[model samples]
Target: MRYLAGNPFSAVTLPATLAPEWSLQIERALAPELLRALRESLDAHCARPGDEAAQCRIARAAIGLMVDSGLRRAEAAGARRSGVKRVDGIRGQSMWTLTLVGKRSKVRTVPASPATLDALRAH
Candidate 1:
């Protein structure tokens, strides 16, 4: 409306009132106990040696990346072994990081837990 009104070859008027507002809904996160239970279940499934066990390992790694690193579904799915790197932290301690290509092809490095890295390696 503002652009049309500003145009010399057109006639338009902006509305006096503002647009209506809507409340945003947010979902609750799972409890820590529930997460622990889920990890235990996945671990149990992973212990069996078979094709299904292999799949369970992959699922466990993906879930660890998503939960611990806050990675999106697509980002977690796209993660690669080459992306995992060990870097020196401020305290001179070596730490693990995962490089991810997120939305819009933006690259980012996120800290990865040792357990998560182990899970990834197992897969």
Candidate 2:
């Protein structure tokens, strides 16, 4: 009898469609690690004495927000004050949540760590 099984070399049974074009879409974008480290360092620069008040606050706020949200740089820029909120969830844990528009017009909810709240308060 003829072989009943499919191609032995193939791992899947797909109909042979074109591979996904992630570059042309906003679904698969990611930030480079080196740039992220640089930005974090720059944000922390404000901790130095004699730093400009406004610039430092901006940096701190930016950095802390990113760290808290675990989002890319672009997402941080789209953050809005109106979307920030403090809520007490289970176990009486209170935290700040940020709602913002992400890539591909997706809306996401991001949490702010204590550090981020402090920075926002400072400004």
Candidate 3:
């Protein structure tokens, strides 16, 4: 008779069912210490003298874009010089932003820090 039921477990609550529901633990961003370590490592690499130093500078710039602007990997990878725009801000100050296509092909502009912009310029 029990086998007649579509699901035998449906009629009873098993001990395993009493366990607490599991929730996903997601890390949204890097910790400050980790971020600092990463920056130091990149800077160290950039300081090295060699042909690879040029590539390191570019890598640092790309990583700077990702860290400063909250850009996704693909967005930073596809970033172009033409996409960087300078606009006038309050009190005649200059503001910089990077325009890029994000997820789902959505076009958006994100603010760029001076340090990051300088890195890009150097690269």
Candidate 4:
């Protein structure tokens, strides 16, 4: 049953075809909890007053953008280089967006959060 279920090309219906559910359960069970704590620590570091604080602020903002938008590493790097630009949104109100070239030379625009915009401005 497991073999047949794993094989997408199999024509037979298996009595036990729980691969998708099992995969999701396994992923949830193995997921890390420390990442959240680490993110909190980074945010705190960015708030501190010191010479490195400026760098920390940028790091926090970049990481926040990545997490919020699910941006690829290359996309994030390109965003940093090109920076965020303000443009007219759907209703003509100004909004922040990041424009960069992704894989295959595709031009992609990523919406920027207020924090990201402030961080880019700081940089």
TM-score of each: 0.71, 0.59, 0.72, 0.57
* Cα lDDT, all candidates: 0.80, 0.72, 0.79, 0.64
Task: Evaluate residue 53 in candidate 3 and report its C-alpha lDDT on the 0 to 100 scale.
Answer: 81
- For candidate 4, give the lDDT of residue 30: 18
- What lDDT would candidate 1 get against the real structure? 0.80
lDDT of 3 by residue, 24-80 (tens): 223566788988898888888889999888988888898888877788789898888
Poorly placed runs, candidate 3 (over 4 Å): 1-27
- List the lowest-lDDT window of 10 residues for candidate 1: 17-26
Q: Which digits, one per residue and each the tens of the lDDT, describe model 2 over residues 65-110? A: 7765666789898888998999898999888888777766667777
Ranking by TM-score: 3, 1, 2, 4
Error of 3 at 19 (Å): 44
Clashes of each: 0, 0, 0, 0
Cand. 3 Cα-lDDT: 0.79
True-structure RMSD, every candidate = 9.1, 12.1, 11.6, 12.4
lDDT of 1 by residue, 1-67 (tens): 4766565745666545433223212245567899899999999999998899999998999999877
Please report the TM-score between candidate 1 and the true structure. Answer: 0.71
> Which is better, 2 or 4, measured by lDDT?
2
Runs of candidate 4 with Cα error greater than 4 angstroms are 1-39, 80-83
Model 3 lDDT, residue 94, Cα: 96
Candidate 1 residue runs with Cα over 4 Å from true position: 1-28
Model 4 lDDT tens row, 1-123:
476657665677746322211111123221245647756787788778897888887787777667555566776776655556788877778887676666556666667778666666665
